[model samples]
Target: MVVDLVVIGTAITLGPLHNSAFILLLTAERGVRRGLVFILSWLAGLLMVIAAVILLTGGTPPARQSVPSTAALAGKLALGLGLVAYGERKRRRPPRPRHAPKWMERPDRVSGWTAAGLAILLQPWAMVGAGAATAVDANLSSIASTLALTGFCVLATSSMLAMELYTTFSPVAAEAKLRGLRDWLDTHQDQAIVSLSLLLGLWLVADSIYQLVE
Candidate 1:
């Protein structure tokens, strides 16, 4: 449960492409419905990862040197190295303006199923994997672990959740504000991804190594 808290903290902090995508989805025709579907899909993906960890560990946190722990640590290391490599690759690319994806341009015609699929597709798999790794330490058999994991899910969805409430409350005013936000998100998306991947990736790699060696 404790490690799960750290995972929640990290999950809440990472601002990925999904943030912008969520906003854009809200700006579309049938925006609310699509946005809700997207969010549910996103949450489901996170839950699926957690479920896998639970099944693997049987609701028990593994010892530092236990097989399950070592496997989880290895998973973290692989994800970290992959993200770091990805970030480095993106960083070395020539400086050029990045454009919004075609899906982002006109969310109006996007079907609900597409929006749902987009959530899963665009989910930060590496980061989510890291969370899943940490969740290996959560004892799902305990009520506390259940609560903590539930909390993690809510925190992970915090940003988009806020936007949904905002749009529902103030539709007209929200559009102008979200449009501006959406544009900034588009322009900076790549840089943001690179920075996050590099930073968190390094942290995950270091922590995994420490756990494996210490």
Candidate 2:
């Protein structure tokens, strides 16, 4: 469970879409406030999912080979296969001219509420689902299990937290660097998505299969 959380957390942190959106928010007018709104919303979404799963399971994993256990693994398997298919399709499709979304162009105009909405909208939900599925195995009675879930949330949100803090403290410096990063992410977003999807998909697929068989 710890291993799964680490991998999924890393993937979420490094995801192109949210990071790109976040960079725009950070560099926009009133960016620090907007960025804070985004980070809080993003963290809230993750917490909600994790809390829901823990509640449903009574904070203990369903027994191995039990129906609930099998179902969780199967759900993860399906999600993994879906990601793999999506990645392959993107990889095989003919390249087209990529343009930044219009919304990205006017980050300065985005309201705090809208920035909050973007956070919810831009989450890598498939990966978040995978994380929730892994959290199924969490035995919260154990300090490690509890800490793992808490740690996973922090780790996943760390990137945005760091960016927001940097921008808040050193606006002039962060703006130039963050804009450069945003442009790079925009240019390479598709490639990043494809790579992340395949790598994480394969990992989830293999791990799910191994657990199911064991």
Candidate 3:
């Protein structure tokens, strides 16, 4: 369970697509306000997926001796295989320059609400789903498991929260350093995604298979 949590948290933190977007928001006019919105929205987005899954599963696992959790495991497996294929395909393709979305370009005009919306929109849904699925095995009926999920959220959101606080407390002083960070994230974004997807996808698929067979 701890291993799964670490993998999921790392994947969410290192995800380049949305993290880069937040970095841009932080660099905007009224960036402190915008960055706060982005952080809350991002955290909520992560929690919502897990909440939905818990509701669906009723927060209870079937008896181990009953049928293996075949359906759920299979679903995870399919998602994993898809991510692996996706990462491999991207690896084979030539890299192309990506243009920032027009909305991203006009960061100065970005409002809190817009930043919030971007957080929800830019979620890596596949990775979120995997985390939720991994968490299913946690017996959330206990306070300990509930706390564990909370910890997962904290760990996953750590990177963004760190950046938000840094930029907020020292916006002028942080600007140059933050921009350098942003540039590096943008440059390595695709490779980061590919690596994360492959690593976590493979883990999810293997774990799912083990659960099903047990």
lDDT of 3: 0.82
lDDT of 2: 0.93
The whole-model lDDT of each prediction reads 0.82, 0.93, 0.82
Q: Which ten residues in a row have the lowest lDDT in candidate 1?
A: 4-13
Which scores greater on lDDT, model 2 or model 3? 2
Q: What lDDT tens digits, residue by residue, belong to model 3 across residues 146-184?
A: 887898898888888988888878888788888898899
lDDT per residue as tens, model 2, 1-214: 9999999999999999999999988888898999999999999999999999999999989999999999999999988998899999999988898777787778899998999999999999999999999999999899999999999999999999999989988989999999999889988988999999999999999999999999
10 residues in a row with least lDDT, candidate 3: 61-70
Instruction: Report clashes for each candidate as comma-separated counts.
Output: 0, 0, 0
Off by over 4 Å in 2: none
Return whichever of 1 and 2 wins on lDDT.
Answer: 2
Candidates' TM-scores? 0.90, 0.97, 0.93
Instruction: Compose the digit string of candidate 1's lDDT tens values, residues 1-214.
Output: 4663465346544575888888888988879889899989999998998998889888889887988788988998898899899989999997786665787667898898999999898888778878888889888678888888887878888888888888989989888899899889777877887888787778878888988899
Candidate 2 residue pairs that clash: none
